[model samples]
Target chain A: MSMLEKLQPIFREIFDDESIIITKQTTANDIEDWDSLTHINLIVAIEKHFNIKFALGELQSLQNVGEMLALIEEKVKKNE
Target chain B: MNEYKLKDMIVGLTQSFSVDITNEMMDLFLRLSGDNNPLHIQREFAKGMGFSDRVVYGMLTSSFYSTLAGVYLPGKYCLLTGIDVSFHKPVYVGDRLTITGEIEFISESTGQVEMKARILNQKNEKVSKSKIKFSLLE
Candidate 1:
């Protein structure tokens, strides 16, 4: 599966909606429940799904799903 | 209050202040924020959920970062632009928390200073941490 495909399920699960289709442009403004509290939950879920850790600084810099997927791909490749 | 210029802030400049989390403070926050979550206001409900007592609203604990930046770090003539916080533990009534802010970075171009903010309970456990961004005002 592609990175977007892998990430799509996680976003759906975090948002508790099956219809969330994410692209590089997808951001907090596009989601209904993407407040600060849920943002942490989404980050934690993404970290666990990817089996990686995100530094607080890195977390602050990610502004969209594409950036997040790029970071995840980079981290996963580094770990392999 | 001391007016801090962007050049005056050096990495490792620090300030510390303490606040006692009293029931009255919680009540005041509850009213101001209109956060009527039972987890913070109802003892039996909180106890049922495994907390020893009502959990003081997490934002109330996090609010100290504002106090740290606006009152002490830059002290005077400061405008808080942003804050990113992580809550590690729940705060309960009567827990005395020491809030500390340390300068981590200063940008001369933007007149913005980034500070690492932390809140530790009397037991010396960190309950919350935040990175706060502020700019010195003229």
Candidate 2:
């Protein structure tokens, strides 16, 4: 599966909504429950799912799903 | 308002201030935030959840970051845009918290600075930490 397809389930699980569709442009403002607290939870969940870690600084610079996907792709490649 | 131009801000600029957490302050914060979580308002509930007393709201403690950025660090002519904080420990009533902020980075193009912020309790334990970003209003 593509990275975005793999990420879909994680986002759905974190937000507890299966119908949530995400694209490169999707951001916190697009979701009702994506506040700071949930943002941390989502980060943790993503890290666990992908078996990678994100630095606080790195997490801060990611403004949208596209940036996140790029980071994940980079990290997943490095691990292989 | 203290006039602080973009040229005036430099990395390593720091500020520290203290606040005493009181019952009245907690009550006022609770009312203002409309966050009536039992962990913060009910002592018995807090104790049942393993705390000695009702825990102070984390946001209440984190709000000091705003005071640091707005009133002290870049002081006046400051516009706080964002804050990212992590709560490390519970803040109890009557805890005296010393909040410190240090400039970490300054974006020349945006005139926005990122500050490393921390709150230490009376016992010198870190209760929370944050990165606060703000811009100097021209």
Measured by DockQ, the strongest candidate is 2
DockQ of each: 0.04, 0.05
Per-residue lDDT of model 1, residues A1-80, tens digit only:
99999988888987889988899999999999998656765766666677776664676777888898899899899889
TM-score for each of the candidates: 0.64, 0.64
Q: DockQ score for model 2, please?
A: 0.05
Relative to the true structure, candidate 2 reaches a TM of 0.64
lDDT of 2 at A28: 94
Per-model chain B TM-scores are 0.96, 0.95
Note the residue pairs that clash in candidate 2. none
- In terms of docking quality, model 2 is incorrect
Residue by residue across B41-77, what tens digits does model 1's lDDT show?
Answer: 9999999999999999889988888888888888788
lDDT of 1 at B117: 91
